[model samples]
Target: MEIFKVEKATLSSVDDLKAYHAHIRPFVLQRLEEFRETWERGDEAVFEELVFCILTAGASALMGLRGVEALRPVLWSATAEEIAQRIHFHLYPAARAQYIVAVREVVRNELGGRLKAWIESWRGRDTRRDACVQKFKGIGYKEASHFLRNISFRGYAILDKHILRSLHAFGVIDSDRPPSTRNRYLAIEQRYLTFAHQVGIDPDELDLTLWASRTGMIVK
Candidate 1:
């Protein structure tokens, strides 16, 4: 569990990232803030949010939305094959479908269909993210962070490829490879938080800023 601290940015790319982050900070904050209202809803919406993360694991956010929008009703009852036929994920449809099923199963059996109550029970980043990691299927650190962030929670980083590559471009991380272990993921996340703090950007808005800067679209 020897954590490797990240190197500071030295590339010319750092300036560009700073400029881009500045422009997108307000917009990303707006989007994340919209989720605060979702918490007022119930567990059905919470389950739907979990389904979004499950569908988006190795796919685009748009593809995940497509699956959620197209198969909203069938999500709880459909077989993996059925979901595969309904969505156009273009990557591991059956597997993602199975993941969706697995998520629903876990929420029903483990949480007793009280996903919202269970999630809101945790008061901090460590407890909430760890609870998500322990209870959910098809969700590790990155996915857990993404889900929590989308639900108006702060203090977690989504270490997806776009953010990783942006970090590499700025000479933050060495490579764009996904962190292979929990300790590594959290270590990198801490490094990003440190960098965000140094730059005076809110930690929660950090992912959206990088993502929007790279992809030209700000989304969950």
Candidate 2:
């Protein structure tokens, strides 16, 4: 992750953050609403979201989205080699391909090819995220949170580099270093939540706002 400065002196004020949030709130809500609608698109759409997150590891979100669009034809049946060949513009296509294939097999064989149903079976949001992290080959805490959030599950923080930097800039976190373990991740996520609450912005909205500030785009 790049260590870009956040200009805390200017952007750290909660009032300033709230002003920014007001301007972009509608777009953020629309993106989140689209996430909620993903559940209606059936397992393939949900699985595609997972693939997008998987491809995002060590890659840009736009690159991941482009890769997913390219691989949609054979996403459910492609071999790792096939997937790797199709997944362009990624830093580690082979590794991501293996992960996608492995996770797809697990879902098809063990989870009965009912990805959406299996995810819906979990009672709590955090429980669902934990299950995803444990079961999926390429997923970690951040990716699991990302997948859940993309599927409209609430309260879990993605803690991506942009988020970590934003948290540090806003004084919610002491440093931009990513949490090294699950416990640490949750702790930092709580800190982010607290900061969001204090500033009167929804955590999800604030996350997107921070992400948009860095990327100049708000996307799922």
Candidate 3:
């Protein structure tokens, strides 16, 4: 196996994000504008966004949205304990319920009893992305990336199967290993960061464009 080298890339502005998005897909400009409008209208809290991210993991956009819809009320009106209890009742496969409780505990411990403070801390700290994500018991690389992307993490890229396949098809990454391995995720992320830099777009925007394009979501 060839070891992949990590290259750090950063997107410091919205303009950079827009340019990258456009490079990835010509229609991304309108799509991103639409998503931004929806995001602004909803004005979801960071913690709420994180919960949505978790719900969306390894699922289709429509399915993810349905899960988020189910999760939203619990997030907004219920305490963490209450949310944990209710999520299990509605969300199935049993493991998802366990994940909810584990995440709640992580937030309580990591944020020192304040979800708002944790959200604020997340925005400023580069290292906190991984640390906060890893705190959730069952969250792995793809889920973590998906969660961070929802919140528009500046330097981070999401590596879903569609994006991974696209990258491999474009010769940007080699698909020689199973998707469950850490090395595969790392390699995909490294390649995506490089591609984002080359195209002058933030990784988050790149992810949005790629997902939209692959999923056939109309942007506007």
lDDT of the candidates, in the order given: 0.78, 0.84, 0.55
TM-scores vs. true structure, each candidate: 0.87, 0.93, 0.66
Minimal lDDT window, size 10, model 1: 1-10
Clash pairs, model 3 backbone: 20-201
Candidate 3, 1-220: lDDT as tens digits: 1111222223344454454345545454444444444444433454555665566564454544555556676654455456545544344425554566567666666655465455446555345556665576656776666555445444565676766765665567777233676666666678888877876765665666655545545321
For residues 2-88, what per-residue lDDT tens digits would candidate 2 score against the true structure? Answer: 122222223567777788778777778888888888878888888889999999877778788889888999988789999999985
Candidate 3, backbone clash total:
1
- Judged by whole-model lDDT over C-alpha atoms, candidate 1 comes out at 0.78
Error of 1 at 209 (Å): 0.9
Best by lDDT: 2
TM-score-best of 1 and 2: 2
Reference-based TM-score, model 2: 0.93
Model 2 residue-pair collision total: 0
What digit string (tens of lDDT, one per residue) describes model 1 on residues 1-220? 1111222332355566577666556666667666675555778877888888888998888777777887888877888889888875447688887788888888889889988888889987788898898888788899999888777777788999988987777667888899999889988898899888877778777777777666667768
TM-score quality measure for candidate 1: 0.87
